[model samples]
Target: MRELVFALDYDPGWNTLADTLADFPDARVRSLSLHATADSLWRVDHATGSPDALSAIEDAFLTADYYADCLATEPCGADSETEVLDETDDTLVLYTYWQRTPVCTSIPHLALEHLGDGLLFETQHEQRRHTWRIIHPEDADIHGFFDALHAELSADVNVEIIRLTGLSATNTATFSAEEGTLTREQREALTAAVHHGFYNTPREIDLGELAEELGLPRSTLTYRVRRAEAEIIKQYMNHDPVSPSDPTS
Candidate 1:
């Protein structure tokens, strides 16, 4: 299969970040900042939300210095260890670093701003229109991260694969590859159809033959084979990276 690479200029990983912080009402999350680590997990310092803090989130655009750090070769997990990482500042935004396995490495930086101690963030994700996300974690103003990412995605947009990850009770999308979700039975039926030349250029094989050999009732066999063909076609049509423009009068 052909491969295509696209970026998530705006990603919404922090949707629950703010809600997560609200859990602690009394002790406002403070000293919040984002830092990349050699391992994973971003160190959020002074994770709190105060009035004066929330005002500092919007800053920087057009130019952002990409910070380089040691890259981790292994995948990160919820149990991944994070220590009091480094600290730095880029003009307006301050960095309170820590290591937490990033959900996806492809996601670049976050828009940050100070909100007392709480932080507001934004990320760029790609689908059709670049999906932009805004987040207010415990404490910080992350407006810039989102801006740069959005800009990058729009700078020169192209078709990109959207990996379905992180599922919750209400969340839906879960396909990694279109075929990733196929069941064993589905795979078997599809394989049989393909092998029997059912999908061969022309009239191909008859349903009765497939049903007899595959040990399925004719109706059942027809449904399964049709379904399998549809899935393959759907995936092919959906996964194509470069596509021809639609002709319209």
Candidate 2:
């Protein structure tokens, strides 16, 4: 199967939110999740990048022109049921439900329905991050999918393909980090790593701070991170063993 991740810098004509997020100098919408079912579209936004960013979020949602009214609003933790931790200063967890119909139909949404049950979609709002995982079948055509999307969305958006890769079953296991198999500790460790920008170049949080935030000893946290990293790499590499002497591997 193959997955394609892309970002769309939408045209102003199609932007449902009236306020420009760029206006806020310090605020940024991070790790946004958009779930559009048959009846409603909900956006769960995680605020980071600045202490006052949460206020920016409040302003955006309050001034958005898409919905007639707010369906619901609530505090949501990042990828778990637990509340946002105080140590993580930038994590402003929030979810807002929009009762009105979507102003514009998303190309990914149509593509998933067209492919039936084989494809999965994960998307974001302000960042407009989109990931599509397609289980390849005899009839599937990657080229055709891109062509169709171009035809449908080109008028209102510039679609840029960021990355595409093929993953066999073994490799995809690590990519997904199967929650069913990972212990709670492992999940939290991995999730925190992502949230803290550990994967980015020039690293945001050091090992010590990450350990402090998770309230674990540095050695224990290192062990958990390595185990989770190993689990993922093992799947990607088809269970090939890392060199015993090189922990960085």
Candidate 3:
């Protein structure tokens, strides 16, 4: 198998969903699951941010016009619907079902057309960037897929190739850890803290400042950072290996 990882950096003016993400730099959305056919797409997404950010994201996602505009196609107004599966101060889970005609150009549809079936997709969206990781057969036409994706996107959307390599057991284990070991919120908190020098002796930023920057409550940010630190320390001390029973492996 081979793994293809790429990112689309959007000019917010071209995509409303990306525009909303641009407005809230601290907000992030990751796909829990995605299933797509020629005529339909079903997706479950997990989002992390402050209450206001989550509310804005929910509004952008549920509004059919947003999808239509993003896809640069005719409206799928009645053909799409979204449900809030769960929500909290810092997290929101959403399920969306969208029906599309062949004319609608979406990433999944493009993948189906060029890469064929039996491909695994992992995706995340944050700060006007959408990243996609696809695991597919060795023989998949990756070049064709990339070309098609470039052709489909508007001139303002920049496509970046992050990785394209033969998948190894080590890569599989790494992907498993990334998707399973840390919750999205935990990862986000830990990343922000580390980036802003929360661990430095002379800290560059305090916990409260980091919390404010992330648009998360102080207590909530503290909990997530603490939990993430504990998890990292445990993993280091125990030298835990990716389990043989792991589904991804």
Candidate 4:
């Protein structure tokens, strides 16, 4: 199995929340999940920013061009089935269901659906980056897939392959490389934290120092490290290899 990760840049004028984020460059959208059915696309968008920025973010969706087919929209800060949709300055969540459009009209989603079982669409930001996990079979034509994808994208949009794994003969791991792994930023933050004695008894480096080293704001670094640690702990505790009775555990 092979996984391909890509950072997709969408047109500024497009309706993607990525475009809206451009309106507030400092704001970051941590995409929780996105799933597309035959008729509609469901997405959970999590955003964070200053009070003024969050105010503008709330208005972004209200005026978003992407929601033209939005059959129903539960605005952020409202009590609903979704838990994280809170009315806070630093955090906002939106639950959206969008009508499916043509391939030419929708750059990535339409192309992803065409891959069928050969490729799995993982996650995407409004205008920043999108990741996909592709499992290659012996008979699969990987090159052809890329060709078809490029044909749909405009010249301005750039696609970059961030990483590739599980191809060497000596490597016999059953799992796909990079499958369900921490994101690049998360990985870097966690790695840096460990090196700076973040997990040590005395804690050599604080959040401020770590954020400075990573060139990210203190808040951003805190979020990244926490999310990364949560994922690592989740994977370790849930993994099937460890037995409850094992002495190592």
**Candidate achieving the largest lDDT:** 3
lDDT per residue as tens, model 1, 12-47: 222222223233233222334333333443434332
What TM-scores do the predictions have? 0.25, 0.44, 0.66, 0.49
> What are the lDDT figures for the candidates, one per model?
0.35, 0.48, 0.71, 0.52
lDDT by residue (1-249, candidate 3, tens digit) is 667777776765777677898889899999999888878888899999999999999998887473522255345343677899999999999998878755666888778887779878899888777889887765565656666665676655655555555555666423223347889899888788779976543346766777899898887886676566445533432332345586754
C-alpha RMSD by candidate, in order: 19.4, 16.9, 13.5, 13.7
Question: Which runs of model 4 end up more than 4 angstroms from their true locations?
Answer: 10-16, 67-84, 101-108, 111-114, 118-120, 124-141, 167-249
lDDT of 2 by residue, 104-149 (tens): 3444345544434455555444432222333433234444555556
User: Which of the predicted structures, 1 or 2, would earn the higher TM-score when compared with the native?
Assistant: 2
For candidate 3, give the lDDT of residue 34.
86
Cand. 2 Cα-lDDT = 0.48
